[model samples]
Target chain A: DQQVKQNSPSLSVQEGRISILNCDYTNSMFDYFLWYKKYPAEGPTFLISISSIKDKNEDGRFTVFLNKSAKHLSLHIVPSQPGDSAVYFCAASAINNDMRFGAGTRLTVKP
Target chain B: DVKVTQSSRYLVKRTGEKVFLECVQDMDHENMFWYRQDPGLGLRLIYFSYDVKMKEKGDIPEGYSVSREKKERFSLILESASTNQTSMYLCASSYPGTSGFSSYNEQFFGPGTRLTVL
Candidate 1:
């Protein structure tokens, strides 16, 4: 069974627009959520993250929102640039447990 | 900066052959992980090591074994390569997450090795 899932396989947006990527989880024990951005052949880079205690966390143009009650989280990027195009993965983990990753959503920002 | 390096960018092996994939991390991390990424399956952990000589099987560990002789290097061995095992292999490293109720450590991954078993 998949504990974490990214329902959307891909998302596209225009430059300078907002891009939203959603993720859901079935495990209630997960207390921390993170987003990672991956280029074509490179490893994934850490993006923003949020603790379950907080509803939202923002870093520069990236913002991550967590809803514990709904078991869902979303990453928002404002003024999305072409460089923002890549695969986004949502990961969640509990204390002492290995992180579970979503299938990843490919984001493409057009000029 | 944390850097994880894999032994190869691509490898092709025949069935029944023994294959070894090596990974090295420069950050002196205590945790190392091996995962296989497929088109729709994303990334699935094959094995992980918490310390030198200590290893744990992840969700999928069949036909795979791992070794961590040194703190900086981890090796994944395929007992007998199979066609189904062809996929992109990824290596990751992270610090030990000992905090109670919070295992929020971020993992640094390698560029990945594409392995093809024919």
Candidate 2:
């Protein structure tokens, strides 16, 4: 069974607009959540993260929102740039365990 | 800067062949992981090592084995290469959390190796 899921396979948005990518998890023990971005042929790089105790965390143009009650989380990228196009993966981990990754959503920011 | 390096960027092998994928990290991280990424399947962990000579199986461990003989090196071995094993292999390393960054789960990844089995 997949503990984490990204229902949307892809998302497209205009440059300078806000792009929202959503994720859901079935495991409640997950206390740490993270987002990673991957370009074609390259490995994934850490983008941003939010702890379960907090509802939101922001880093410059990127923000991650976590709703523990709803078992959902979303990654918001404001002023999405053409360079922001890549495969975005949602990952979560429980205390004292390895992390699990979602299927990933390809986000394309058109100019 | 933290750096993780993989031995190869691409490789092609015939079925029933033995294959080895090597990964090295300069970050001196305590944990090292080997994962395979497939289209629509996401990243699936094959194996991981937390200490030298210590290893653990991840979500998919069949037909895969790992060795951590040195602190900076982790090696994944395929006893017999199969078509189903063909995928992009990725290596990642991470250290135990510090203070405020309680989510020290941030892992640095090496450029992946795309392997193909004939």
- Chain A TM-score by candidate, in order: 0.99, 0.99
Q: What is the lDDT of residue A7 in candidate 1?
A: 92
Q: What is the lDDT of residue A81 in candidate 1?
A: 100
What C-alpha lDDT, on a 0 to 100 scale, does residue A108 get in candidate 1? 99
Chain A TM-score, structure 2: 0.99
lDDT score at residue B79, model 1, on the 0-100 scale: 99
- Model 1 - which docking category? medium
Scored against the native two-chain complex, candidate 2 gets a DockQ of 0.53
lDDT of 2 by residue, A1-107 (tens): 88999999999999999999999999999999999999997889999999899999999999999999999999999989999999999999976677899999999
lDDT of 1 by residue, A1-111 (tens): 889999999999999999999999999999999999999988888898899989999999999999899999999999899999999999999888888999999999999
lDDT of 2: 0.93
For model 2 the TM-score comes to: 0.97
Per-residue lDDT tens digits for candidate 1, residues B1-118, read 9999999999999999999999999999989999998876778889999889999999899999999999999999999999999999999998886663224789999999999999
* iRMS per model in Å: 2.1, 2.9
